[model samples]
Target chain A: MINEKDTRLSKAFITVSFIALFLGATAGLLQTLVRGGVIELPAGIGYYQLLTAHGVLLALIFTTYFIMGFLYAGISKTLGTLYEVPLKTGWLGFWMMTFGTGLATVFILLNKATVLYTFYAPLQASPWFYIALVHVIVGSWMCAFSMWRQYYIWKQITKKKLSPLFSFMAVMTMAMWFIATLGVAAAVIFQFIPWSFGWVEKIDILISRTLFWYFGHPLVYFWLLPAYMCWYVVIPKIIGGKIFSDALARLSFVLFLLFSIPVGFHHQLLEPGISHSWKFFQVVLTFMVIIPSLMTAFSMFAVFETTGRRKGAKGLLGWLKVLPWSDVRFFAPMVGMLIFIPAGAGGIINASHQLNQVVHNTLWVTGHFHLTVASSVTLTFFGISYWLIPYLSGRTLTKKMHKLGIIQTVMWAVGMFLMSGAMHLVGLFGAPRRTAYTTYSDHPQAAEWIPYQAVMAVGGTILFLAILLVLYIAYYLAFRAPKGETEFPIGEVEAAAVQTPIILENWKLWVGISAMLILIAYTLPFWHMIEHAPPGSQGYKFW
Target chain B: MPQLETNKPKKLKKAEKEQDLKGTLLSVMLLGLFIILSWGAVYALYLSR
Candidate 1:
């Protein structure tokens, strides 16, 4: 059982996360309805306002708070009373993040900051928006520091022993996030904030964009690694299998730390200010980052096969049938992995310089990210919530609720398939994303995208219903269920011939390499942008 | 308590484990192949456009 203090901390973070999820999802439904031409947007609330709110609340608030809460619970459970993470510091971080979210939400609601989540300057937001975002980042950094401190103390106490896999994964996730936020931090602090305050007359759009993408790509990993943590540490145990290899799991996280941050240039491939050589260099790094994901796929399948064989299943692919598919905890994350197979493949297409030309700035990009962040990451979080809410609230997840969970995931998969699939098809036919209304009715050339948009609207309605089901389940688990403690399922590794290498656990060495890589990838590009700086443009508000 | 014919079953289990490992490796290879083919198809479509 978790101590009272730790439980309270986790609960606070998770509660706020759910609040963010509800608000963000509401905005999502409104945007979809308006875009589909099914309903007109209410006056005084622009489409960009809804868009900004959806991105901030879901991408920034929901994911960050949920991750913070999950890591805290994971660390507490794995380390036990042996390590004391300062509860006071954690509470401080929570308040800061909450206050910051409130500040940002005000601006979004007022339509004072309709600069989308990318917030590319020349299209400026209120100064308060940038300041509010900095608070969110700084708040997250404090929480990360607290977790890192606990790890440090544990390491000091147990000199040579490798940290528990869950704790290790949690630390790696936070460390990657802390590093990834540096680019955004620089952009906000140096350029955007100053210009927004009228302290600077104009801002360099290219430089700001370059900085944002630097954070943008790794930001996806920041969302992904926690889901991966659950996949690596929890899913195997739920499925009645042991981890395939402990060493491989650690190696994968290490690989992510080394490769995830420096490859953001792939997002800027079409931009003119950044040169081809630097972009090519980042493209190579981008492909290299795919190795860890491939490693995860192999390890997961191996675990399934071994476990299925142990249960007396025979023949190739027969293992698939023997594994547990009914348990919501197991079913949700496994389905997430299945969706990611296609999503990851789509990501490869997005990263490829030649192929990206066909899909850039189109609904295809929207479709790709929806498959990733919306389907894969969001579904995994939904899965985590099934157990986590019950565990935190000391409640039993009843049988009825388990059935609800199953319906939620399956319906979500079907809905997302329809919506994202239609999006990809229509995108290829030249439908633009982020547009409130397409003049497809007037223009014959754009008419091909209309039917697909209708399909997307229908799919989105189904998805919105699925979200409601999830919220109901979460509410039932948290407030209505019978009180009981749930176990943290940390999978044990099956016996292997080889031992985990000591080098994989060397945090200092790995951090050094990650820093060196970022420096190599970013230094020259930033220098070029600064030295040969283009004429800056004044901020404008079209809305 | 008598230890009655445990060795034979132990040997069989080990053999099965080995077979499963090989199968797992094969499955990984197949998945990689599938991803590559999917990418190729998508890129080809893009080229046609």
Candidate 2:
């Protein structure tokens, strides 16, 4: 059924990944230009609708594509077998998702459902919009299944234990993905479809957001883990060092799994409908999250230390000098590390139960997420593409492209630093997020923030250009390649041999997941408390 | 497989990190102290203010 003439599954995934980044950049730039009033399209012509398209296309879809592409590319190197699942099935999935994205984009453009990314309950979009969303999530499920089937085949061939660190993390993340998307899927099918079509009287806002955040919170790590996976695996290889502590990375994944879901209650902390004690409990547990986060930081920095020693660099800060600066893969992760600082600071600030009052739903919260989610994670994905695409395609990414990638990476990092930081300041000064427009009446001088908006627009423009370059390079390597089999090291740093996870399949872990669900369900309650702040960003919408 | 490497027993006892994040070690101790102090400050200033 197969020939050497058949197209590489990696090629299809890379193509999708290319398009995803391109669309993501295009949508991102469009939103930024709109925000700055630099390029005005007619106001109230379904602007919220455009925002929804941008959110789903760039944030969720792009991330999904890149991670799936990266996974498909590494099949043999990761599995230690030449075995592969049917690339045709994956191609089938590719078209299904691609077409779904097109349908959803059209609906968004028509302003059929401008529910914003959160798409809070009671505020409904059209039935088409809900259906389009179902198609997209379902398409992602198909992609996940395709990867799992490949893993199954690889295991069948190897029969070795499934303990390769990167592979384990990939499957763990997929495992997380299948579980995490349930909340969003549940909301779409049960609440959104019926509610949007006028089938249900009205769905509850608070409870829906709770379930949404159940998916949403873990979804951050879902966006994030692949990037971290690249960090753990790729960075060490690029720098010529083994992983500093492989077990710590594993522990971090497990801890992330445990914490990311239960901590959604922290998001509901200020909501009055939730019990005081439960909110307090989540706040405490929320702080526990930084353990794995910091553990990762330490683990990787230790790798850098090891790499630096290999490079003959000296002193506590010596690694700074010898790290492959021009190699976009190496420096992008380094820059991503720097971006994490204030982002982490913002996260800790927001996760604080009492402190959240000052910044909740404000520009500050948006600022924090953009830094962590958009900058740190997205940059790392781009960084991975920079390293992997050429290797997978058996083409050499030239010095100039890598050089240009460094410039683009810096642009993104610096741009985010300026943009997210400025947004935080604006948020503290009472600027609300998610509004299509802002009006100043009582405080005429509220116009001072215009400069910051302008600065953000400039930053976003630079990053947009950077994203375009990344896509172009990715396109060339995947499609235009005059190629042979390229041997890519899927970073053989895990000295520990592969062990198939008996623990992964355990009934106890399943119970822990259920208990996690139960714990989150018990904690999610902020919908009814409209006395202090309006349910749907009420306090900040101006007169 | 993990047991193969971890045979060189952990010098730091589990008791240190075993509790709900309390007591001893450079990173953990400092991080814990930072957490407790920050929580105390937030409750006092922002919540009670």
lDDT of 1 by residue, A1-543 (tens): 888789889989999999999999899888887777788887788888999999999988999999988889988888764245456678778988888899999999988999888888899889999999999998988898888888888788778468889999988988899898988999999999999999999999988888898899989999999999998889889988888888999999999999999998899999887899999999999999999999998888988888888898888878889988889998888888888888998899889876888778888888888888888888888889999999989998888988999999999999899889998888877788887867756898676677788788888888889999999999999999989877778898887524788888888899999999999999999899989998999999988
Backbone clashes in model 2, listed as residue pairs:
A161-A499, A161-A500, A162-A499, A162-A500, A163-A499
Query: What level of docking quality does candidate 2 show?
Result: incorrect
Model 2 Cα lDDT, one tens digit per residue, A1-543:
112312265556667666766766676777667776577766665446666767777777777777777776655466543234446556666777777777777777777667777777666666787787777778777767776776777667777554577777776777677777877899889877876676656566666777787788778888888878888877888877777556667767777666666667777777656677777777777777777888876666666665665577765566667778877778887788667756776678788776888778877787888888788887887777775776666666667767877887887877787778778878776677775554466466567766767776787887787777767667766666556444354555535324334565342585477466545545334433333334332111111
Q: Cα lDDT for residue A326, model 1?
A: 84
Candidate 1: how many backbone clashes? 1
Best by DockQ: 1
Q: Which stretches of candidate 1 lie over 4 Å from their true place?
A: A81-85, B1-16
Model 2 interface RMSD, one decimal: 8.0
Cα lDDT tens digits, model 1, B1-49, are: 1243464766665675677776778877877787899789778977798
lDDT of 2: 0.68
